[model samples]
Target chain A: MINFTILENYFPVINKDIIIGNYTFYIKLYQDKNGYFSLEVDISKKDTKEKHRFVQFLLGLGKDEPNELSCHDSEVPHFKIDYYQREEEAFSATIYFTFRNIAEEELIDYAKGTVVIITKMLRKYFENEDIDIANLSEVVYENSVISELLDYEEKVIDAFYICWKEGDLIVRQKGKDNFVIKTKHNLIKYLNFDYLKPIYLPLKEKIEINEKINSSSQIM
Target chain B: METELDKIQTTITIPLGLKNRIRKLKGSMTYKQYLSKLLRDRNKLAHNESYIEIQNLVRKSAVYSFGYYKVTFTYNEYNNSENFIFDIDIVEIRNKGALESIEKFKKNMLGSEKLQSYQELILTHKLYFELLEKAIQIEIEPLFSHKSRMDDYDAWKKEFESLGLSKKSFDFDVMRKLRTLENQGDAF
Candidate 1:
């Protein structure tokens, strides 16, 4: 079960965070007063080598602007890098994935895409670290789904639980307003494509092919 | 014919001059009733003034003060309840003292035990933090890159001037255009 915090003080800011290895991934879905929605993810870690590796990974995605990087294969818009030193000993580099001016109906899809990208990055980070990246991705996916449900003001949230059935996730709300949400994990990868022509094809396949080609190549 | 229930009878020691002034001001009302009315009016005046101050603060909407943050309390006419928005601008939080004050404010007001009751406050605080987080990403960190770019521009300008190139060859307007392009190329 993934824990999600629905911050009700403001306009429906939902936080679904996870920590893997030394990195902490802070994911948020927010709606502004102007009714525009944004999904922001900040991936931060203190290790210097991790920062270098992360930057290298970002370089693989073409740099659209000075600090903005974009993966043409993914549904996510772009990524920005920032450096923070809250304390002298706690310096960290953070990668911020920002999607602004998104519509409410499209928020869930963007949120899912954000989770997928973060999962992909974590999987790369833990490629040789013996960590179960698949399990982590599943948890992140479930957390994102829960966040989406919470965003719709789904009542009886405490009664809800998610379980894996075959290759899909089954979310059941037990008490009043009972319902079940059965979704394929890959459905999240290719929700809707407004700009891209191929709407039905999962973008993850393209990303995986690119990753495979890059891995096989000797280019640093 | 004023009912006794509508008034409270009381006696207190006071200067004779004050008593004479009170008697003259009391007019058609009892002195005790007038004094109570004065107390109520004074309280109302203070309350109204504070409300006005809060409204003004909200209107100003710039969090520029040092070591202090503002929370404007507003009355919801429809619900007949009080609500507040925690307003803080990350750019204006200039000094370490101001940062310390924010830390203390969050600690005292956003403590876990007190937070359950002020869930709205927590949510509002989180919103401000989100804004600040974005500001840090977009504004604060990019400052270094901007500074280095400016420095490069400055160095280039110095080198060009030191070269003693004919000033009449390049128009001032052309130089200004180039400078703008160089400085603003990568700026958002």
Candidate 2:
């Protein structure tokens, strides 16, 4: 089984254009041994109307074959969208897929293709005039900080995990930096890393130490 | 995205044996003229949206009629840093059924005939590599340099790094191994 999570913060609002609201976007994907894969997307509840519209747009697109390959419900497919209100707001959607004797390479290809399609849909939604295109790009480009860690020379690192804490998303760079960025309701309009933490070697060493301690405890 | 026209040019002398072969071929042209023609043909093909069609056209061009060649150069950048990379790859476009033809040709030829043809083809390889090396030096090298803005790299690197895990210890070897195994497909 494999699990992947993406967290985005600091959405942008421009020129009082379109709707003025704060938003958070989270997407999770999981694949199980039983040849089943699931995708979950969570957005702020305040943006429920827009989220619902986005969902409907996806459903419409899915119904229409945009590329050479299209997804249909009959083959290892099921999906659900859930909405909830917290102190802020959130929207959640999940997609499950059951594979049919497919090779791992095929599964990986499907996952990559699905990610591209979903991202394209979101980009279209955010860029549509009905939605704030400029602000959407700004928010996504600015607040989506995870790309930095991912692009690190593949020789240096492999993967990353993010955690939410104290209303802020804390980025623990697996072995290096642990940066805690304060959440903003508005789209991220400005980004300056002057005060951000630069936890590199020290955090990695600490993680190594902790692992050793945990293993020792298990033996004891 | 304005194409930079200023290029530093360099030339390397071709060996007499290869030059002699070029002289013997009908409709033969100088290396530079041949390359210029190839580039012109490639440009026309590239503008066409269909890659497969472009591939076909490229095979019919002078580059293929003569032989294969490779052109390599660093792209434009600032601060003396080579930021961009460019290559003008030219390869011989064989007839659609050339591979099968070559196999048949090899089968029909006796020992001495096969030896002579193989020896002659080596000269073609040498000329192709030489033309490729020189074209890149003259046409492509000048455009490459460091990007104008310092913040670009930092911001790009930051955004790039953010896309994956930051820790150095994460083991992606499994993912790579899985891909390799999948590619090998029961061979292992």
**What is the alpha-carbon lDDT of model 1 when measured against the actual structure?**
0.32
Q: Roughly what TM-score does model 2 have, to 2 decimal places?
A: 0.20
TM-score per prediction, in order, is 0.24, 0.20
Docking class of 2: incorrect
Which pairs clash in the backbone of model 1? Answer: A9-B123
Candidate 2's C-alpha runs over 4 A off are: A1-24, A31-36, A40-101, A134-220, B1-188
Q: Per-residue lDDT of B97-181 in model 1, one digit per residue for the tens?
A: 4443434454555665654434434433443433422322232232211223322445433432332221211211123223323
Best by TM-score: 1
- Residue-wise C-alpha lDDT for candidate 1, range A119-153, written one tens digit per residue: 34445445544566664552245455445433332
The clash count for each model shown is 1, 43
lDDT of 2 by residue, A134-190 (tens): 554543343243343323212111110111111222222223443444433210211
Comparing only chain A of model 1 with the true chain A, what is the TM-score? Answer: 0.32
TM-score of chain A of each: 0.32, 0.31
